[model samples]
Target chain A: MSQLNAAARAPLDSRAKMIEFHEVHKYYGDYHALRGISATIREGEFFSLLGPSGCGKTTLLRTIAGFEDISSGAVLIDGKDMSDVAPNKRPTNMVFQSYAIFPHLTVGENVGFGLRRDPRSKAEKAKAVEEALEMVGLKGYGARAAHALSGGQRQRVALARALILKPKVLLLDEPLSALDKKIREQMQVELIKLQREVGITFVLVTHDQEEALVMSDRIAVMFEGEIAQLADPETLYRRPNSRRVADFIGVMNFLPAQILGEAAGHVQLEVGGLGRFEVTEEQASARASGAEPVVGFRPETLTILYEGQQAHDREAPATIDEVVYYGDMTYYDVKLDGVDAPVRISMRNVFGRPVLDVGTRTRVAWSAGALVLFR
Target chain B: MKFSSLKGYAFLYLVFLYAPIVLLPVFAFNSGTIIAFPLKGFTLDWFRDLFANQTLGLALKNSLIIAVSTSILSTTLGVFAARASTRFKFPGKTGVMGLIMLPLVLPEIIIASSLLVVLLAVGMPLSLFTVILGHTLMATPYAIAVLNAAFSSLDRSLEEAAYDLGETKWSTFRLIILPLVTPGIISSALMSFTISLDEFIVAFSLAGKETTLPIYIFSQLRFPKQIPMIMALGTCLVVASIVLLATAEYFRRRGLAKTGAKDTGGFL
Candidate 1:
């Protein structure tokens, strides 16, 4: 971790500093669209810019692709500055959210368009185009006009068009945002495989938390034009450094906690209003220097136990308000005394068992290690 | 839908507008020299006479020269103006665009007469050059209107993707934008030609020594003996105009269809 920390400070020390945005600011006349955005994407990494809408993820992608210019700072490609380079001149291509498939051209022509300028023979271009189509699993779709294809087919064409160029970096602006739920799920799996097959830097911009979590090597959660947190999916979800990052990742329940005592790597916290409790060590060390902080825990960390189980350590006697079956997992909306709202809890479903009905009095227990404290 | 009296009146109005020009060819083919109510047997004599008239022939040449030049020039300027207006923004763009499109609503007589005064003050002679200038100015707005629609309907991302793929702005336009809008350009060229060919008032005001086919035909109307020949000339011109106009309309419709738009809105 210390070596990793030193390496991160020296960006040039890594061979994988594929695209780096430095002090990037963008303005559209009056509106400050992006303010001082800085992030680095490593080579062969499937990185996601995860944020709410209007958080400037798409703008950042566009800027990297050269469709948009940054008002201040530089966008470096592989280490060189790309301040005035146009979109066509960049070593990046984008699979636009709309898929942006040319309606007038056939799928082959659309994919072959970028390769037309290549120093390859006509046969070579044709072979490349064919290979691109095959990669997208749309073999023989070359002759079909873009508009004639289905939504998924269009997406494939879009992917093929961007990927055929063998651009150093491929930007996906919410690529899965347009598809239906089932198709989106399928595409995500296909995208993961495709990313591995290509082994190119893939910078995807999306607002969907689960999409980012499942698909990214690193996820940057943005809020109001700045990165709230940048980490691997697990670390981003479980060890978020800020309250905003915790709230944005998953269904997290936060409660105000006061630190009774503090040390270098430990702190004591009084969390529950009705029943006082103290949590220490790693969780406490994750909080800010002061005592005024918030305690956050994901739903999966909480477990609802039966009434027969005596009130033991790490058990919160919370009554179930509602139960929602999520196929693989069951989500319970629990209302504990002294808590502001119904705290959510998720439990893996066991097959061939009596279900936990709603309005049941049950005690829920979560491992103290799973809880994260934030300022 | 049931037809009504107003529909009957509208149908009559359409016939009234077109009947004389339509009948011109019928009478030109008539064997008799006198154009009267009586039906005469068909002959090709007047058509031959129409081709033989040396002065009329010269006028036809001059009109063709002026119209073709004007069409080419108009379409070129129209392409630039339309592309700029539709695809970009600088400053005072709307005002400049409104000014370019203003001639569509302004009366042609007023425009022609105004050009006469402006050209005379500028020391330009009333000739084919003057006629070409006036026709080009009048026809350009129409060209812009047609091409503007063609350009704006274009998917902007196509060009951006081209740029993203490493093509410069100029190359992107030359390779991508030009191909997409070529149909509109072809239609605009044809439409401008037809309008210039059919134009008379502007030619009359600006073409002093060098009279066009329309002014020549109008001047010949006073001579009683040339009536049959003029009728023949009119018949030929009417036919040619119909063919040109139809060709222009066909290209325009084809252009619109190419861009996936159903409406064939055009200047002519």
Candidate 2:
């Protein structure tokens, strides 16, 4: 996983910008849909706009496809201003959330829809359509009726139809949202592989944070018509800039903290359950959300030490409040001796270790380096 | 042997509706010129006389022209109205659509009289053209009603997909929207044609000398000798209507099959 992250991040500085949004604002009557969205998508990068519903992520994506016009500011595609370009004239294609397969046409006709104006011969276009279908793993399924396919097959056809154009950018609006859990997960991996294979700039809009993290090279987390944070997946997961972003991304346990001192790019903090510790300024977010300062950590970062185990970092004495077990991992909600509320700790279930019961006494091993202080 | 009250009511209602139509064919083929039948022998005389009548032929031609023109004009207007109402939002949209669909409930006599007054005030001479104008005004609301269902059920993204695939707005409508809504268009056109063909108040109020089929039929009702021939004409009209409706239903089912859409109980 770390190797894949390194490879995805290695060529960031040398890539050209494929899409640029410069202070774009969109309004529908009285409601502001996108508030001054400014971002640059690198060439061949798999980017994602992730947010909850009504967060303007889909609206931002439609701007790139020219399906929507901004109320002010500009959008540039491949270094050219796209103010006057129609959707058909723009160098982009979109896979709509509905899949938008033409029910009246066969899969082959739907895949070759964009080639109607191409100067290529009929035979060449047919070959291109077949090749596009094969790329989406629907090689000999061209003659099938579009409306007769299942949900997953329809999505594959939609992907083939959009990719056949070979546009500079491909926009997907919640493409896998309608599939079942198993199919959705399968498509996520397939989409990542397909993006790498095509090497096109893919801008995906999804409400699923896990989907975004798994597929995107970089993600822009949006909330209420504005981007809250934009960074790569690892940075987004490890170092969220705000409490809202942290809460939205994944499970994070918060413990009340007090600031003691700051010097030399390090900050001293007194935490509620884990007692006193210091964190680097990079680990602390300076943005204040008008709440009490809290130090947060992921559930996996806190390990419940078993009998005869040694602690590598600081140790906290706690009592198990609740126990929930999966086949592969066990979660323990433990209350530290000094804290009122229990914080969750996740431990991987090894082959020989037995799962602990509720109300058992335990010691939690944690490190200050894995904690993020949010104010 | 145990019939429900509701079933009996339905059976009686159907008989009440169809018995008059059944009698038209029965009397049309009867040999006697008298309306009352007591085992009258079958004959082709009334049908032969119906074909030889020149005045009836002229009225039929006039009605055909008026109905054809009204159907085309009203359906074209309905397409624009339905598309605009379903796809786009503008100021006072509800009020605009309400006004367009208002004529569906308004009495035809009121529309015919008001249209006659306006056309005469403008010194537009009354003819089959005037009748067609009045019939189109009456039929457009029904056409819009049928077409609104078609346009509203279409996915908006389908048009966007076509546009994104490099087709212009016109081509997208021609290739995608038009073909998809064709069943609705045919339904609307047939409805308009039937309305204009059978309309009496508007044709009587607007047509100065040009007599349509309904006006001629009404005029012939006074002469007792022409009653049998009128029954023959009514029989032919009923047969034509049945054939037209069956053809329309066939096309509608074929369209649904081609697109794999569910059959939601279309017009029979």
DockQ of each: 0.42, 0.85
TM-score of model 2's chain A: 0.97
Question: Runs in model 1 with CA error above 4 Å?
Answer: A1-15, A84-86, A256-267, A270-274, A280-294, A306-313, A323-331, A347-349, A353-358, B1-38, B222-238, B245-268
Tens-place lDDT per residue, model 1, A65-84, is 98788899899998889987
lDDT of each: 0.82, 0.93
- lDDT of each residue in B1-268, candidate 2, tens digit only: 8899999999999999999999999999999989895948999999999999999999999999999999999999999999999999999999999998888899988998899899999999999999999999999999999999989889999999999999999999998999889889989999999999999999999999899999999999999999999999999999999999999999998998888887766779
Query: Distance (Å) between predicted and true CA of A157, model 2?
Result: 0.9
The deviation in Å at residue A75 for candidate 2 is 0.8
Worst 10 residues of 2 chain B by lDDT: B258-267
Q: Which candidate is the best by TM-score?
A: 2
Model 2, runs deviating above 4 Å:
A1-10, A286-288
Tell me the alpha-carbon RMSD of every candidate.
Answer: 4.6, 1.6
Relative to the true interface, what fraction of contacts does candidate 1 keep?
A: 0.48
